[model samples]
Target chain A: MVALSPDLTGLRTPALRRFLTPGLVALLVLASLWSLSSGAAGLGPGQLLAALTGDGLSARDEVVLYQIRLPRLAMGIAVGAALAVSGALLQGLFRNPLADPGIVGVGAGAGLGAVLAIVLGGLLPAGVLAVTGSHLVPLAAAFGGWVTTLLLYRIATAGGQTRVTTLLLAGIALAALAGAATGVLVYLADDRQLRDLTFWGMGSLAGATWGKLAAALPLIALVLLMMPFLARALNTLALGEAQAAHMGIDVQRMKRRAILSAAAATGAAVAVSGGIGFVGIVVPHLLRQADGPDHRRLLPRAALLGAALLVLADLLSRSIVAPAELPIGIITALLGAPVFLWILLSQPSAARG
Target chain B: MLQIDDLKVTLGGRDILHGISLQVRPGEVVAICGPNGAGKSTLLRAALGEVPAQGRVTLNGQDLRQGKPQALARLRAVLPQDTQAAFPFTVAEIVAMGQDAGDFAPEPGLVRRALAEVGLDHLADASIQTLSGGERQRAHLARALAQVWQPVGPQGARWLFLDEPVASLDLGHQLFVMRLMRRYADAGGGVVAVMHDLNLTAMFADRIAFVIGGRIAACGPPDAVLDPGLLERAYGCRIAMNTAPASGPWFVPQAAQAG
Candidate 1:
């Protein structure tokens, strides 16, 4: 029972429908080119093509193009794709368009782990330190994400069914808990440690490397590949859980897989990229508003848009404050917050939920 | 046939249903009517295995809890009171979701036929989120109809559990849904509805089960269960009962008589 709103026609106008798949891919290519050209080392298309073909290029150009920009670009694509797809999966799971990775404590959980590693890494055993070495922070962050996800999911689910509302509320409470823990860890950090913590909290791809990408790529790819199988199930889930079950979806199994996949994707992305916020929420929300909420179209398109947005944002982070990069997270937040407010203002009913 | 035997449900550590028992047979519509918070919806949920409960619910002599979700989906469909599909799915797309749980592959014509039966054939391309509440309810009914479109299953008889299916509809659409359910029953399917409108229940239901305090206080044919005393006791209000010239029985709440 709802009072009729004035906008009786749907939100999918022709303008909104213009960027489904092909449009997004085309934009992604242009953005990627722009990113490749504008880095600290200005490697134009000729140099990029030379690097690609293993043609005539100086060793410095080779290092910048292959070691630095390429890895960062690759990491951006993986992290962006992961976060956006995870958000779409979550929104579908919750049966609410506003659901995001942060709603489920993944971002906070990863932040807490990173802070702990930064503040407490010296106190850890030598064998553990030796084994992880420079990779200790990302490893801890990923593990923290996994633990928090499992805990939140366990607390919210009873028997086989996951309560979407409960998961959301629990996530909020868990995020607060993780935040307090992160704050305590930050308080204990030295000046240099605090600086590292702040930069990591804000998020960056500055730490990108072939090794980190290699480690995280499999997890991100597996989660993305697993998502299409869930498209129909998630579509049915748009109706409430009971109807989903009544329609013959193993509602419990679907919920489990969705949560796990989202967690895995978010964990991998956060581990590699630090705290890149808003891509998850902003990309999917914008896509759903533009196109209809068909997960079949929504998920893949969100992935493409998310990858492009993050890649472009990463470029801005480096170029906006040249020689001293702004954190990618800050760029995304600056861009995303206004769009989020506009969406809420326009769709007041969706905002209430 | 669908049978509920000694089904007890407790929510938030409070008993909501106490050993409720009922049977729904093919070719008949059984209406469960009760006052607010009388466990009418809870009974329907328990019957559909959407909620946890004690005791046994069986469809065609097979225990409902033991059946796989896919297997049970083929045998029955449920239409809940809240038809809030959050996504902006087209009516045709929403209707097609009915086939997701079925054993057989999707039949495109079934979606169209189900939409037509609910008088929403013209709005098949419209977004479900843009439709009025009543229209959404009809679309959900159409979804349920499309789910059990075969009308008969390899098992015994297909069952439909509707919780206030027509609560949001106008008079014409309400009758349209009722007739559709009637025809569904006529086609050898069983339907159990949680109802509120006494007149519609009297007109449409083959049998009435008056629920009170989480139990079936009375159940029988329309005339047999239409007594004002039973309704008054169940609803805690005075009720005026009347028989229509053409229809069978109708009832409305009366102002409290001075003690």
Candidate 2:
């Protein structure tokens, strides 16, 4: 039967969305537990629990838990949440379902920044090197993304109106330019720098450490903190920029903040994890299909679902080749494409042709 | 009162509106009628501050140019000519957006009541994409109504500025909406609409403004402004004038229980 008043049916879906918070959190917990256990140095659930409480732990197990597995899990959750939430924000801001930070030039720009720092570190002064210490690459990557987004915004936005076509075209051109610049830097790099670049370029969760996680976490946290306030504004934005403005949303300010948040999230994630793809696109798209597209529901939920999906993917990445690892990017593209295609085909008027 | 004084707009090296001046008071419906390319929508956009224009435009004694959007929103709402939802939001969710302006709590039940007023209560749960063009227009109208739901709030008379509000609607829905406009004016709100149908304007509007080449060629009540000779000259087409309806109210939406 057709649901007769939105009073009855409209509120129901959002209520169900809110009710899903705990369930998604639980899924994240399960994924995290499974990830903490399944690896090169596999531990059972009991031992996993024992490793946590520091009760009857072996020195080697302790080393693995604190240094390897824990940091990896934390980084997976952080980067996953960051990528996913950035995807949700870009989709909302552009009012296009297909929009993603990776699809745009933001990630590519960050990648160039990481390469620049890696290849040019010798030219920096000793004092500056001392100041940057271990954070040179991630900081450069975040700054690069921020600059690219601003440049893209300048190129594609005219008089407070974003030209989606221009944005898409400019993104293609910008990504190509960044890729070329990265190539030149790769050509410039010495042997040791080439090794760092190669390992980083492959996009693995294998080398996650507390120091790398700490460098990226603060920026991602800022993006996550700014998201909730954007929820209501982004929901109204789906009605068009002018309509959103009519609803008293400060369209200019909201647009700036949204771009900033997405750039920071994408930049920080790319800096630490290299180029994990499809999490941003697939997570929000799947959630919107399962529930609805209200950004209030989509944003935080995307974070949790993204984290869980990545953790599970990472688990599969290492275990499928046990004692060796496949790049996480390959796994996501492999997994996400089929699920995304299934969703598209299942919709009754999928093409609406 | 909403005032536009000597307002002018230029776009892409062409003038759209030139020193157009008008005033709308509470408890009245004003219609702007003109042929295509006569700058009717441009005038409306200038008033809403959607396009930057020179000269003075004010609502309730506050200058629209300097007035904060949040403050302006509480006093007036606009229904754009066309809108497409970027996502699959429900009709009720679309209307609920109108319930709040910037920093105010939504008026409880306004979304339901607005949907009912628009004869869309049954389809409130439906996806906005599933709606026909006419239905979509009405859904947006319902949202516009919910924006300034109370005819007169603490800030004096609330206002709705609609652009071709009935352009996509069917005959029955058009009359229903015209009557709704009449009733809204009767309850002390003000409305300014860019109108296409002259008969509906004559039937419902308290004042009429005829735009031609970026200026008001004629302005007054329907009896004075809708002259056949003036309309014929302005439109460059032969015109006919009559009042009687050959007609039908067709559908009353009895469940809605309103005019």
Worst 10 residues of 2 chain A by lDDT: A1-10
lDDT digits (tens) for residues B1-259 of candidate 1: 7888999999999999999999888999999998999999999888778788998999988777657878888988889896667667889889888855664455758888889999999998788877889999999888888788877888878888899998999999988989888888989999999999989989989998889989998899989987888887777788888888888888888787612
Q: Give lDDT tens digits, candidate 2, residues A1-353.
A: 12321212344465676667788899999999988877767566788888678677778877887899989999999989998998898888877665667767888988898889889977999999998877778778877887788888788766544555677788788899999999999999999999999978878777799999988888899998998889988998888777787788888889889988888888888888997887888999878766778888789999999999899889889888878888899999997776545543443342221
Off by more than 4 A, model 1: A1-19, A52-54, A117-139, A147-173, A186-202, A346-353, B12-14, B103-105, B236-245, B252-259
Give the alpha carbon lDDT tens digit for every residue of B52-141 in model 2.
899999999987655777787788888988778867788988888888662235456778999999899988888886788889999999
* Candidate topping lDDT: 2
Query: How many clashes in each candidate?
Result: 0, 0
List-wise, what DockQ does each model earn? 0.63, 0.46
lDDT of each: 0.81, 0.82
State each candidate's chain A TM-score: 0.82, 0.88
**lDDT for residue A248 in candidate 1, whole number 0-100:** 80
